[model samples]
Target chain A: GGIITQTPKFLIGQEGQKLTLKCQQNFNHDTMYWYRQDSGKGLRLIYYSITENDLQKGDLSEGYDASREKKSSFSLTVTSAQKNEMAVFLCASSMDNTGQLYFGEGSKLTVL
Target chain B: SQWGEENLQALSIQEGEDVTMNCSYKTYTTVVQWYRQKSGKGPALIILIRSNEREKRSGRLRATLDTSSQSSSLSITGTLATDTAVYFCATDSNTGYQNFYFGKGTSLTVIP
Candidate 1:
């Protein structure tokens, strides 16, 4: 069984700083996704990639950017961190976008 | 717009008791997925129910879908403390191939 690994599980950033979170999956799935979850909130899609070098924006992609440089990795960037806020960013991959999704542990970001 | 709405009520149940959570969606969806997320952990898909299939089960978990009502339910029997988590229901029915939409989840606490 392959694993999806997210880097720097805990991240601290200053207000207005640009923060990047990285995810790597060895499942070799064709689709990669980025989502953000606030406390007591559901997951909101930020961005997703259907293949290598592809990008698609989601409902919450306004303040974020994503890149799929390779098939096995997807990364998300927060353009400007909000002060005194915290959110968990999750990375997921799927063999098909409409099928079962596998998720990475997550990256917790705290903006100071 | 395809969106899901899960009951926001927080449930507390004793271990080994049965619990059920309900979710309603708007729009015609091809597939529905149920997921669980433990504290500080990423969400994982527990079951996927299609429009045609009314019910599916995996171990102690059972899922039921009602296409006419555009609603679904997840039932867990003989619950364990480890089963305490937030459960979310997501849909894959989009406007001309759109991204999945999720709703705020139901939080369940299995008390010992």
Candidate 2:
């Protein structure tokens, strides 16, 4: 019955600006992931970490960076925002790579 | 290209009707997970069907997996308004790494 919390539910950034989103989970899971979802689209993986201080890139990781500083927290950074770029970023954790995942509410980003 | 891609089907049905959503994947996967996402929220796991299992059910929801076709389907019966949401199918490929890919999603609106 643990929860995943994501900070700054909504974000507005200017073009070329850098933005960071943070996530925390109390499930003591070993795998964490960050995904981006555009309107009317599916979730695209940006990055994932199997353990603390580990990082792996996904198909859509060109402009994003991720960090798993601790076992309970994972963060994502947008290197440079693009105008009219609006998407929802989700953070998820799993007990293991092949198990069910628990997700946070999400952080919505709007670039102006 | 995305590993798992939903049909992008948007379905509108009455409360008492039944609906089914489909997803297709391009690569080998060990498991397929169905998720439901309400507005302004992260996706929630509804069912997880493994490659070894063909069908799985939970209450009013049912999921079927076909490894030969590399596809899966989710069915909801006697839907309620609360069931209105976007549905996604995620594939977990134990490719010596954690590779979980999500489909685009199917948006379902249960009309009262």
Candidate 3:
């Protein structure tokens, strides 16, 4: 069994601040994704990486940047925070894009 | 418009009762996936139903898909307090292994 780990489980930021979230997985999966969920709302895909040095944009990728430095790690950066934005950022990994997904605990972001 | 956006809404249900969540996508999909998410946690895949299959089951969860209508439904039987969470329907387009697009998700609360 493998685990996907997300760093800094909780984040507190101000409006217009830049926040970075990190994710690491030991599954050695080729695909990784970043999604954001607001309270009582559905998740929106931000970015996905197929392999090392690869990146793909999803519907909500406009304000976020992602990097796949290596096969085991993927990172997401919120270019500018918005006030009253309290959402959870989730990291996921899968052997392939259409297979079952393994998710990290998630990083909660609170913008004041 | 890759996946029909109609299946992307949330739902609420009562405990000990049965509730069904439905989804519809615009594109041709070979596989359909169902996921559950609790408060403060990442989503977890519950069941995966394929194109040729009409129904799939796992414990108290049942999922049904109709290719002609481009629709899928998830039904939870004998709901419990632990079943209070959001359910997301994901579809993998016939394009193959490109990625999954998720719906808005249904939020169910099994009141005790």
Candidate 4:
């Protein structure tokens, strides 16, 4: 069995500060995704990488950037943290675009 | 925008009772996936139904899809308190480059 690990389970940032979340999957999946989850709002896709060095924007990608430096590692960056913002950032990987996804526990972000 | 509207926003039921959640999408999809998210964890795929298949079952969970109506339903029998979580329905709508679009989700609380 493979696992998806996300770093810094809890993160605190100041308003306007930039934050980065890292993810690594041992499943060797070809597609990786970053999603922001807010309570009662469901999960919103921020960015996804179909392969190494490939990036695709989702509906909620305006304030975020993503990088896929290697097949097993994908990272997301928050351009500017919003004051009092709190949400969970999830990292998920799929074997392909049409397969099941395996997700990390998540990285909780709190902006003060 | 391709996401479906879930039937119930939230539900509370006894541990041993049966429960069902419904969702209806607005666009054509090749597949629909049901995901469950427990508190402090990322969502996990529980069941998936394809356009050609009308029904699929796994253990105590059953999923039904109606392509003509663009709707799907998930049923769980003899629920346990551990089943309490938020359920989301996702569709492979092929919207943009992103493959899956998810609904707001149905929050279920199984009272033990």
**lDDT pick, better of 1 and 4:** 4
The list of candidate 4 runs beyond 4 A from truth reads B96-98
Tell me the tens digit of each residue's lDDT in model 1 across A1-112. Answer: 7789998899999999999999999998998889888877778889988889999888888878888999999999998998644788999888864577888999999998
Ranking under TM-score, best-scoring first? Answer: 2, 4, 1, 3
On residues B4-92, what C-alpha lDDT tens digit does candidate 1 reach at each position? 76756689999999999999998888888999999888899999888899999999999999999999999999999999999999987
Tens-place lDDT per residue, model 4, B17-96, is 99999999998888889999998888999999888999999999999999999999999999999999999998875654
Rate residue A28 of model 4 by lDDT.
79
Candidate 2 chain A worst ten-residue window by lDDT? A94-103
Error of 1 at A33 (Å): 0.3
In model 1, the Cα lDDT at residue B61 comes to: 95
Clashing pairs in 2: A42-B104
Q: Given candidate 3, what's the lDDT at residue B10?
A: 49
lDDT of 4 by residue, A1-112 (tens): 9999999899999999999999999997899999888878767788998999999998889888899999999999989999645799989999854568788999999998
* TM-score, every prediction: 0.95, 0.96, 0.90, 0.95
Instruction: Report residue B23 deviation for candidate 4 (angstroms).
Output: 0.9
Question: Per-residue alpha-carbon lDDT of model 3 for A27-106, expressed as tens digits?
Answer: 98999999887765566778888889999998789878999999999999989998755788999999964589888989
| lDDT, residue A28, model 1 | 87
Instruction: Please tell me how candidate 1 rates in CAPRI terms.
Output: medium
Worst 10 residues of 3 chain A by lDDT: A36-45
Error of 4 at A7 (Å): 1.2
What is the descending DockQ order?
Answer: 2, 1, 4, 3
